[model samples]
Structure formats: C-alpha cells, structure tokens
Target: MASGNRPVLTVTGLKKSYRSAGEDIAVLRGVNLAVAAGESVALTGESGSGKSTLLHLIAGLDAADVGEIILDGVSLSELGDAGRAALRRDRLGLVFQQFNLIPSLTVADNLTFQSRIARRHDPKWQEELVERLGLARLLKRYPEQLSGGQQQRVAIGRALAPKPLLLLADEPTGNLDEDTADEVLALARDLVARTGCGFLLVTHSARLAATLDRQINLHAGVIA
Candidate 1:
C-alpha cells in the first residue's frame, strides 16, 4: 500500500481471468484506480468493458486472478475468503442494481440488517437512517409494498447504516426512470458525502458520472 494519508482505496495491475472451453478469457488487465476519503468516483464503460468486474474486485465479492487491491490500508490479495468476508461485513457497504432486500423483512428490519450481521445494531442510528432515507412511514412495510424508488432508497439506507470505510455501487440506478434515478443517486451521493467515506460507483450514464468528484472510463480491460 502507498503511504501517508492518501486514498482509502488503490489498485495496481488488477487482473481477472477465466477459462471456458479450454480458452483463457481475460476480463481486466493492468487496471489502476484510486479513490480518496470522502471522494465519489464513477467507472464508466460500455457493456463488457469490465466496469462491474472492477467494482466486484474492489469490493472483494470476486477475486482477481492476479494483481493488487488495497482498500482502507489492507491488501485484498492478502486476505482469505473468510477474512475478506469479514472485511466486507465490517468495513464495506454495497448497493446493487437490483435492490436485494429480503422479501419477508420490513423496511425497518432491512435497513438494520448489516448492523445485525456485524453484531452492532444501534436503534438510534437505524432510526436516523429511516428518517434520512425518508423511510420512516415505510419502515413497517415489506419490500413488495414499496415502489422501485422506495425500494432503492431502502437499499441505500441499508448500505449506509453500517458506516463502511468504502461503498461500492454497481449500476445502482439502472432500473429506475430518469427522474427517479437522479433522485436516488442524489440521495446516495449526499449521504455518502456526509458520512465521509470513499465511494466508487459504476454507471454507463455520462450525466450521472459527471456528477461525481472524478470520472474514469474502462476500455478493453484497462482504465482510461
């Protein structure tokens, strides 16, 4: 890792590959990225340019076949699956394009899910999250009872309630209408900024990417 109060996340020569039908498939090669504390960065790419792969690697949801990933001072290459899982639970938060809320859980329960996993539930924090995410009224309702926008808001609240060191978002607005997407992204950006955590969001929309602190493109397995 690089020294002295720099970025919370850094990558050098990050690579991922797979084998199918006796052929080697390289998804990402020699990608480099850096996201500092409280900074929002967008990863933009055409379909299959490896934007999602990069985010997964950074989040430790998937492994790199080779290369280095350092997040919040720890190298991902050095951690085992169990170690990485713990790190993700304790220090990372994720938002997916699909709002993966549990079907049976109420809004209140879903928002505090991470806290339960980490054994660190704070009722007050969850309450604050409910209000901030505009989920107070919906707290008693289930996922099926909410609209796409409301569901996404709950997803954001769940991710943010953990106070993670880094937040990874993968096409978070892909399913929403333009106005709703903008609104959800706006709330997400605002909360992440207020919490002072590093954020890396993947999107194909130039307009959305433009709203971030910095924007970079991925092309042919490399960051541009």
Candidate 2:
C-alpha cells in the first residue's frame, strides 16, 4: 500500500515443517517478506494458516527448514543458539497475546528485564517510559496484582524498554476486552511511532490490521 526503502528486515524463500502422525506437514512454503525500519505492518490470517509460526521464525524462536531471515542486515540462520538468543535479547522486542509477564517480578522489574538482559538499560528512558506507559503508580505491583489490561500494559512496557531494532507482536490484544484491547493497542502504536521502531503484528482482527501501514494475510504459510 505504501512504499519505503528503510529495510529493517528481509525474508526470502522461507520454509518450515513438522512431522505428525507419521506424516510430514509443511507449514510454510517459500515465503517472502520485507519490512522497512520505522514501519508498522499487520500480518493476519485465519485459524491454522501458520501466522504464529511465521512470527516465531521471524523472532528467531524457531528454525526454518529452508531460506533465510535477515534482521538489521545480519542473517539469523548464521547465528548459533546462544548468538540467536543474544540477538533476540539485544535487537528484538516481542509482545504476545498472553502478555507473558513474570509472576514473581514487580511491574518495574518486568519492564526492565529485557533491557538488563540486553545491557541497554537506560534509566532516563525507563523513567519516561514508566510515566508514558502509565506504570508509575504500579511500579511495585506484581503481575498477579494487576488486571488483564494493566498486566498487558506492563508487558508492553517491558518490550519497549529494551528499545530493540524491531517489535514482533502476536495477537497482542487477543486477551483483553474490546475497549481495553483498543487502549493497549493504541499505546503500542503510539510508543512504536515515538521510538521509530518497526512493528510486525500477527492478528486475527481485520479491524486492528487496518490501522497499520500494510496488511498481509498468511494462508497456508504463504503471504497472500
């Protein structure tokens, strides 16, 4: 729909497969994708179209049977597990539908975990984020102490704290009520824009995808 040449991520001939019931199931077949820096893109699909699989592959959480994934000019396939983990820790930000916050940590700790792991923790930026994400008052509260919406906000704060090269969101609003989902999604949009980070969102809602710069649907693992 729109055009840009920033090129933060690129994919070519991507493939993934799994074996089940003594049969080989091919989830992705030579998929190709490109995302520019500072852009927001929506990835949508129906049930079992391999949307999550693609997101996982792009995030370096899963391996591809073939092809390549290049992030910020570095090919992910070339990195070992430790290297990939480091890349994910340092250069990538991830937000999921479940809001995977650690139960033992307080809001502040959860928010700063990624940054600490990546060795990019900026105190000034963290404070601004606490206020901007509306997390200032909840800093001492743990994940169990917050509501679904509040917890999701904390998760978003954690992902953004690291200030990674790219943000990967998988059904980020799936667990919240419509109004709350709207609020969290809005916050995500605002922060991603403010930081000029690239976003690749996997969602089932066409309504949500419409707000992004481009919408690409995954069908049988191929972008349609």
Candidate 3:
C-alpha cells in the first residue's frame, strides 16, 4: 500500500478516456488515491473532472487504460470478469445518485436486498440499520410510496447492510435538499464508522466534504 499500511483500496497511475465525436477525450490521467481501512475520504471536482470515473474504475465497472487498482490487498488487474463480479458482490457496496432500488420490493426487503444477495445478511445489523435510518415505520411501503429522501435512506441501508469492507458512494445525496442530505450523510458516516469500513465518497458539496476525515480534489483528470 502507498502508506506502508494495509489500505482498503489503492489506485496507482490510473488513466481512462472515452471516444466522443470520433475523438478521444481523456477523463482520468495518472490518477492515484487510497482509502485506509475504516477511514473516510471525500472526492470532489467540477463536472467532467472525472470524479465519477474514478469511482467506477475502483468498483470495477469500467477498465482503465493503464495503471492498477488494489482493493483489500487484491489487484483488480489480475481479476477476470467473473472474479471482478464476485468481488463486487461479496466485498463492495455502492450508493449511487440514482438510488437504484427495486420498485417491487418493500422498504424492508430493499434494505436487505444486497446482503441477501451476498449471503451475508445479519438480522441484527439489518434491524439496527433500519432503526438508525429511521426506516422502521416505512418497512411495509414500496419505493414508489416513499419520498426521494426516504428512498435514499433505504439505498444507504442496503449498501451498509452487507457490512462490506469498502464502500463507494457517487453523489449519494444529489437528489435531496441540503438538510435532508446532511442527515442522510450523517447516518452513512456513523454506520461506516461503526462497521469499520473504508469509505470513498464522491460529491460536489464542499460542506459534505468537510464532514469527512480527509478530502481529495480532482482537476484536469488528476489529483490536485
């Protein structure tokens, strides 16, 4: 690891580009980052600065043009598609701006969905998350019945339920009002601390970044 300590995640000389209008546009250029076990880091940058690209790369949703990603001491470059998929399923948790909840499932079911899929579901942890997220009252309701903030809480709950080693959040508060966003983030940080999981949060909110333990700013496809 970069710090000589075992980091939950580390990225080295990462690069990524996309083809647009018949020309290649670079999104990430020689980017490097790390998140220690149980530490929280905020990733901030303006639009098109590749904040989300870094998260996608770390999550193994997209491949980099060069460099390496190490998660929980495992190199992503060595993993095949199936291995990547398994890693994501068993060791990673994601919270996106979209709050990708199943519309058919009730709040209770949605909260436990990822954990069940990972086969690491703990009834006690699920109950605690439900209480912490203030979702106990909405358990029987479906996603369509909940407001945007409520759905987001459910999403956070789902991500944390599995107690994964690493959590990647991409603008998880994008759709909420400032106050609600703060509340949700508070819950997330608390749960992450409690679970002893490392967090890499991507956000445009400086105020939100301030709440984290450390902050990393990305500019022109590189850490600034």
Specify the highest-lDDT model's number.
3
lDDT of 3: 0.93
Q: What's model 2's TM-score?
A: 0.97
* CA lDDT scores, all candidates in order: 0.89, 0.89, 0.93
lDDT of 3 at 210: 99
- lDDT at position 124, candidate 2: 92
- Give the TM-score of each candidate: 0.95, 0.97, 0.97
The count of residue-pair clashes in candidate 1 stands at 0
Kindly list the per-residue Cα lDDT of model 2 for residues 14-72, writing each as its tens digit: 99999999999999988998888778999998999998999899888899999999999
lDDT of 1 by residue, 100-181 (tens): 9999999989999997898777788777778778887898999999999999999998988888888899999999999999
The candidate 2 region of ten consecutive residues with least summed lDDT is 1-10
Residue runs of model 2 more than 4 Å from their true location after superposition:
1-5
Error of 2 at 177 (Å): 0.5
After superposition, candidate 3 runs with Cα above 4 Å error: 1-5
Clash-forming residue pairs, model 2: none
